[model samples]
Target: MRRLLLASCIALASLSGCASMGGASSSDIAAVLASPSRSADDRQRDARDKPAEVLALAKFKRGDTVADILAGGGYYSEILSGIVGPDGKVLLVNNPGYDAFGKKGYTERLANNRLPNVTHVVGPSDALGIGEGVLDGAVIVMSYHDLYWVDDKMGWPKVDAGRFLDQVVRALKPGGVLLVVDHSAKQGTGSAAAQDLHRIDEQFAIADFRRHGLQWEAAIPVLRNADDDRSKNVFDPAIRGKTDRFVHLYRKP
Candidate 1:
């Protein structure tokens, strides 16, 4: 309970910082929501995938180079490409396991679309293939916890989350923002349970990032809910696809 209050205070401070920056206009929101490269189904998927209101609140700017870490299926990759425009680049971080999961069909789709600004990377589990101090910002959406799944079968030679985060920190420019969103789990819940439940305890995540020199930025209830019991698996029919989630943003200090 004490920890929860502390987190609440930290979130309020971050919200104040965000409020100091000007918010996006409705027209800008429409432009992102209506991007032609995104299919109708893709746009609909964005609602649950990226969530426009949340992205807008993130204040991602045009001409800002960005990285979409763990870019599964390239859903957020497409939206980010549109947001960054032609001058800015978007690197899609694709691990070998992800490539195997998506197969050659994923490669063909990108080739057919011809997104010149988008680049696909296949690199070590610890490091993204981007140069240092080049990125403006990076986002890991519902995929950060997968770092825990790195094993021989996953083609990840190592399973060290610390090493993985070190690589992420190295890839970013000084003061670069790293926004993470994942399913919220209960307190004291460890990684083993997180894997079974497909959710992570928010406090554990914050502490892990802090250990890596990341400053707590914001915690938004934009997708939060108190109803989830965290007892069921994420794929369970009841709360599988519709679990209450949290969006936490962090920045390199």
Candidate 2:
């Protein structure tokens, strides 16, 4: 029954002509962050994450139909639902093998209908299964490196990054935002550090997106940690949640 309920929600979101707002404002974010409904853990991360700033930079507006790609257990989904309001929708896209990382089921976030305006999309990374011209924006947060790092043994199929991003680009409305926040690797290593260190070279990523017709917009250092040496895994005890990260915001134009 839980699976059925989740499927129904995804179907509702997949339908074309869903209403989406144009641009977001500061109040939209402030209200979402300040809402008492947000979990304690969610609020605790504010000092490190600054989600309000992330949302503002991404231009996520009220009534917007956005996809929280690689959204594990709805941390961002819940916040987004509050920001977008009842009229809006947040489609949480999770590729296979996502549960192993968190030791939680794919429906953990969707269970009991905790987020009334949220939907779960389970599929291959390259084919999002979302409709064209339907998304106001899509935010891929802290997990872009997985496109190059996911191994077959992990039950996740190899992602064709070009196709995956192409699909995301197609789903957005004109001038729609596609914001990627990821751990920063060394200056010239490219994707070499993805599997081991769980990071990616910033310049290499920009070039990859440009190849897919995504226009470069802005890069913010909101999550920068100067002490991180870009050597050990992101989960290392020394830098776990404090690794230097780059917020690369782009557009489909």
Best-fitting candidate, scored by TM-score = 2
Model 2: weakest 10-residue lDDT segment is: 11-20
Global CA lDDT computed for model 1: 0.68
Off by over 4 Å in 1: 1-27, 150-158
For candidate 2, the TM-score is 0.85
The lDDT, on a scale of 0 to 1, for candidate 2 is 0.76
User: Which residue pairs overlap in candidate 1's backbone?
Assistant: none
lDDT by residue (188-238, candidate 2, tens digit) is: 999889988989999999998889989989987768888988887999998
Candidate 2 residues lying further than 4 Å off, grouped into runs, are 1-22, 25-27, 99-108
- Please tell me which predicted candidate would have the highest lDDT against the true structure: 2
Residue 84's lDDT within candidate 2 is: 67
